[model samples]
Target: MNTPPHFGTDTPRDLVGIGIGPCNLSLAALAHPLAELDAVFYEQRPRFDWHPGLLIDGARIQVPFLADLVTLADPTSPWTFLNYLRTHHRLYPFYFAERFHMQRAEYDTYCRWVADQLPGLHFRHQVDAVRWNPEHDVFEVDHTQLDTHGEAEALGRTHTRNVVLGIGTEPYIPDALRPLVDAPGVPVVHAADYLTHRDTLLTAGHITVVGSGQSGAEVFLDLLRHRPTGHEQLHWIGRTDAFAPMEYSKLGLEHFTPDYTRYFHALPENTRDRLTTAQWQLHKGIDATTLAAIHDELYHRTLGGGWPDTVLTPGVRVRTAGRIATTKIELHLEHIQQNTRTRLTTDAVVLATGHRERSLDRILVGLDPYIRRDNSERPRVDEHFRLVLDPSVTATGCNIYLQNAERHTHGVGAPDLGLAAWRAATILNTLTGKETYPLPTRTAFTTFGLERPQPRVPAARQAAPTLTPLVDRR
Candidate 1:
């Protein structure tokens, strides 16, 4: 099999993607068809694996199978989920199953299948830094290749006209639980490592799950099912007012469309910040189906006798956590609405806290002087997802792009799987300075703001797409 040639060549590439997560994989897949464009992606890990720890049995992705790495951008591309099924000779079975959402494990396998076949993805290669090279009119990217054990085996450099940072989010641990997690006595673990610690957790006498998001619900449900019926001894508590269901109504789903993203970006900085928090239900709440499954399980356990020994409470926050002697743990909790406080003792704790977008400071510190920032000191990102760099860097015809790091600007859809392909296609079009993949003029049924949005054109009435001449605005 022919692979992309190693770096250190005389000619520079069009773009160098920093991380080979699903976001960058989508970009690479879309970029693959544009013959004039040259792109490569590097990942620190050995191969592609999405949320391996939270891939609980029987769980499925939130979106439909069509929300694959390439389908939303170019359904005709050979990398679509349907094509994967056909190639694997599972098309008939999948069709008969009639499942809209694909299983989590199956989706991981599909991604690995794509990652294995894509030529330019260099796994086990860690990107170290990025800097602007005015002399060469390109961006300098330094990377280190790692062996199986993740030790640096060799160092290399690549020059590219543009760089795309797809290094995704990291598991976030709140301050209150830091010491407990860091300490060795208790089996405190994040949901990101739930599968690895499942056995240890099950053996405990009592367990407590924190956070009210989908992960928390799933973890609590899984534990509830495994524990004996009467003596479940499980406590599920979170900071939310209620175990609210995610906003899954068709119109509410439109917030994830490109139209809403445009409107959100156009808002004032403060408004965008407020909306990110106010619109939490769109992305952070538990799925209705998962909630139903949990309720059903709890109802089943109550059919025989009184009730399961589980304490499910919301509107509570963990004030702090400490070890009780050597075998147990103590948690200081406060109810947000009732203004009440209490303490709970548990044998183990599972933190289902969500992730936060990883900071790009270490990798981008080299070019800090040239990058523009917002009033809050956050790096400013434009509608095209390019970092607002100083004119000096821009005039040199070099650029840096971002994925999954623009939630402050692009709204909640920044980390969404459904928008991955669309964003990738948008980036490619911006890079090529042409409509390489003709995107729809509009995507949502609702107008985001009062301002007149582009008319929703029907497929039959849409005109022939026009190509705009490339301008060297850099």
Candidate 2:
């Protein structure tokens, strides 16, 4: 096979993406048909895998199938999920089954198919650092190729007119539970790795599921089904007041639309921070289906006129955790509503505490001095998804776009699958200065705030489809 053109030679590439997750993969798929664009994506893993650890057997993606890599931005694109089904010759079966939300494992498989066919994706290449070259007026990306054991075997560089970071997120282990996870003999594990340790966890006399999100509910439900009904010694607890269902009402979902993303970005930094904390249920709550399934499972177990030996408590926080001898875990707890404290010892604990956005500082350290920051010290991201770099850096005429890394600026939709294609299109539009993919003029009916004067260019409507001059890569 012929190798893709190498960057850093005679002419710089248009864009060099660092991390080939769904976000950048979307960008690559969308950018593929654009004739004037030249791009490459690098990933550290040997192959594409999205949330491999958390693809529990029957867990369905919250978003519908239309939220694929290219459909939302350009439904006609050949890379749509529907096309995947058609290509795999399962379109008729999919139609008969009538499942709008596909299973998590299936989605992971679909993503792998997309990644395999997409061009210019280099896996096993770890991007070590990115630096700006004032002389060449481009960004220099340093990377190391890894072998099977993940050790560096070769070094290379890429100079590009722009770069995109789609490094994605990391499993968030709270400070209180870190000791328990790191402690040798304990069976405490995050929900991200639940399937990997399922057998060992199920054999335990007692299992405690922590956190109240979808993963926690799914894990608890799975355990409920596997254990004997009469002796199911399971405990599920979290800091939330109750096992709350996610906000799935038609109107409530508008918060994820591009119109709302624009409105949210316009708010003051402090206001955005406050709103994120207040609107936890919008994205962090359990799906109604999963919640219902849990309730149904519990109800079925109670048909014998006796309650299953399962304990469920909410509004409870794990203050500390330790090993009880070498076989069990002891979790120190506190009640949020009432001034009460308690402790529980279990054979195993499953933490579904969720994930957090990874920091880009370590890789972008060389460009730190040239990067701009918000009041909270986070790199300021503009409406177009480009990092708000310093004037000096901007003067070099280079762009640094972000994917799934702008939650503070883009709101809950930052990591949402539904908005992935649209965000990718938006970044491409800004990069090539053209409407590479035509987007919808308006996506939501609700107006965010009428009082505040709107900008001349409405966020709801993108600029017209006019060809803009592209920056010469030479």
TM-score of each model, in listed order: 0.94, 0.94
C-alpha root-mean-square deviation, each candidate: 9.6, 10.2
Question: Which 10 consecutive positions of candidate 1 have the poorest summed lDDT?
Answer: 1-10
Per-residue lDDT tens digits for candidate 1, residues 370-460, read: 9999888999999999999999888766789999999999999999999999999999988888999899889998987796678799999
Look at candidate 2 and tell me the lDDT of residue 184. 80
Candidate 1 has what TM-score?
0.94
Candidate 1 segments whose C-alpha is farther than 4 A from its true place: 1-5, 452-474
Give model 2's TM-score versus the native structure: 0.94
The digit string of per-residue lDDT tens for model 2 on 1-474 reads 113336347678889999988898899899989878888899998889888778887899999999888998988988999999999999999999999999988888888888898888988889999999887788999988888899998788888999999999989999999998887886888998899999989989999999999889999999999999888999999999999999999999999899999999998999988988899999989999998888899999889899989999999999998997799899999999996999999999999999999999989999998888998899999999989988877877798999999989879889999899999999998888777777788899898888766668766787778888999999
What is residue 256's positional error in candidate 1, in angstroms? Answer: 0.5
Candidate 1 Cα deviation (angstroms), residue 173: 0.6
